[model samples]
Target: MANNDDKSQSKNKPFFEVQKVENEDGLGDIFFGVDDETTKFPDYVVDFKDEIEYFISVIQLLYGDTKSESLYKKYYERLFTIADLAFNSPQEKVKLAERSLHKLKSELTTSVGQRIRTKLLMDYLKLAIWPSIIAIIIVLLGDSVLTCVLAFLGKGTENIYISSLGLISIAAMAGGWISTATETRNLAFVDIVSVINNQRGILVRLIFINLFSIFAAILMIAGFLKINIGGLDSLQIVDSPTVALAFGFALGFLDKVFVDRVEAKLSKTEAK
Candidate 1:
């Protein structure tokens, strides 16, 4: 009877030892290590030790930086619990522990990524809001605002070409703003992350739109591009200031398509 009890106890003994070491803050750390009898450990137990150590290191790195301390602490505790189970539990239960740890790691990583993306988006909005507002105002006011500035400087405000140029530039800015707004509204989480990562691209895109708008407007003014209304053949785009302003707005609104077409045409010309 005594020999049978000894054999049963030896068979039920765990492969690893877990010790609790308290920090200065009194929150203890779980020391998960192999037993002194190193040769008795199985191959899977060694792999679990390595993976759990890595998980602990990652948790420590993200603990203070994450927004919700309680949430992180919960995951930290769960990680150690899974490690303990992986080491101490029967061979059949080890796979369950591994799966749990993997799921927890995925959730923690996604949470951290989302928090980082949210911060980037907020910072971008703060920098972009004022410029967007100013652009919209300039677009709406167009030549009236330009005329006021020119009048204040005691310069002639009657030049049709000057007014047309101002109109084109401001209208282009408005078109770019509208395009950006629409794109932002439709963005998904991953798309937003990409946008936030490249915030400077938004400004660059607006600049391109303005440049293309101005270029197209110049072509119209120079008689290289013509618009003939179906019934009113007498009213050409270049002849009237009102028509010029509307045409500039259209060019600005369709800046991307216009630019692409221009590029394709240039590429074909080069091929020829």
Candidate 2:
């Protein structure tokens, strides 16, 4: 009876209680290249047993085995380099490598939907910022500008005031469009077609920025001249409507020309 009891107890001894549990899912043989009758280590993946063991320990500390395994597979081309750095490098460096992997994953080939959303959001910003604001302001201040212009520029200042607002929008929008074109020169030639198709959104933002910036500049100049800008009672902005708009338009066009001349002059001076 005792012999039978002893045999039963031996059979009941759990495999886990006898030894440290191994990864029996075949990853040990495949990833680490363990040698046995049932498995063979490939020449490429073989590392020292101690090195493999230590690497697994360190990585497991950072992430679960499943995550680490997935990352190893995904970044297989850079697997050893990443693993080596993570094991040997300082904590900060290791963290950086991990973050780089995540960034690559996140930004990897943006979807069509993502591109459209990004482009649209940028366009909406353009419309909201200066273009829309200036448009509304120009419409509201039409009568005031007419009154100011008629007093100064003589007959039919209202016509001139209306014209000035239109000019501001055109100049601002054109400048912004050109700037956007320059910005996209680096995109692949093939990609530029798609960019062009979606450019309506981007064009809107630039228009707004240019429009508002020029308007603000006009306001500042007007403030200097002590012009009464409609609804803008502050010390800054238009002394007279037509003059302010004309000055801003000239500046919007001439600024780039002036900058180029200055650069050329400086280059000649430096060459001498």
Candidate 3:
């Protein structure tokens, strides 16, 4: 009867328990229960053991003896508890736990300095790529659209192919992309989190930059805005395709400056 009782108790035992074992090097290792054939854990659970151990070591390296050390210690403890549950869970339950662990790991790692910087570059790339593609499409179709518009207005379509508007608009887009990329690259890691959080705003800004550039190009073409290119012997942007494109690029590149000035003026008016 006693032998049967002992077997029942062993059968009901949890698969793993967390214990700290000190090695000869005086460093502690996380031991997940005993290594025996009776403990049949899935391969993913076993793999996660190594990952969690490594993560703990990284936390120690990053936050050790710092003001945030205690807070991170609490985080580690919480993760350890979840891992403990996962190790003892059934296969179906383990999968859910695995996803939770991965999410936690991602969130923690994203805040790391190097990771944040990489994310900043990636975010800027996403912001730049879409607008550039749209600009290219517009450029390719611009001549057809110009010809149609001129025909509708009873104007000559003969010089539509020579029009500088499309090229200038695309140049403006390129300038905006460069300007935004420069700003993103110069951001400190600490500020990157806020930038990442405001992805929608950044995307809108890119769109605005493209539209503003197009509008400025139109104004120049209509003689509402004039720019005299230096060393071009009094050649105005409207008269010279190459000069017009350059002017559009400058307008796009200085978009941030223009935006800031306008905002400053608005703020002053509001203060009064």
lDDT of 1 at 114: 59
Residue 209 lDDT in candidate 1: 65
Q: Per-residue CA lDDT of candidate 1, range 6-97, in tens? A: 77766666777766564454444567655575457667767767777666555555464436467557866887788767666643256778
In order of appearance, the predictions have TM-scores of 0.43, 0.30, 0.45
Report the lDDT tens digits of candidate 2 across residue range 1-272.
99998777644332111112235542322133212432443332233333334444333332335755764444333434544443333321344445554443333223233454456446645654665566667757766877886788766543334444544555545554445445554453234345645555455445544555455554444443232335443242234545544444444445464345445755877899
Candidate 3 residue pairs that clash: none
lDDT, candidate 3, 139-255, per-residue tens: 578678878999999998874532455566667766765665666554542344455554546666666776776666665566544445466411355467677678667767887
Return the top candidate by TM-score: 3
Report the error of model 1 at residue 129, Å. Answer: 10
Q: What is the lDDT of residue 163 in candidate 3?
A: 43
lDDT, residue 139, model 3: 57
Model 2 stretches astray by more than 4 angstroms: 1-121, 124-145, 148-162, 185-272
Model 2, backbone clash pairs (residues 3+ apart or across chains), number = 5
The residue pairs found clashing in candidate 2 are 123-201, 126-205, 131-208, 219-237, 227-239
RMSD (CA, angstroms), candidate 2:
17.8
Local distance difference test values of all predictions, in order:
0.61, 0.45, 0.62
Using TM-score as the measure, name the better of candidate 1 and candidate 2. 1
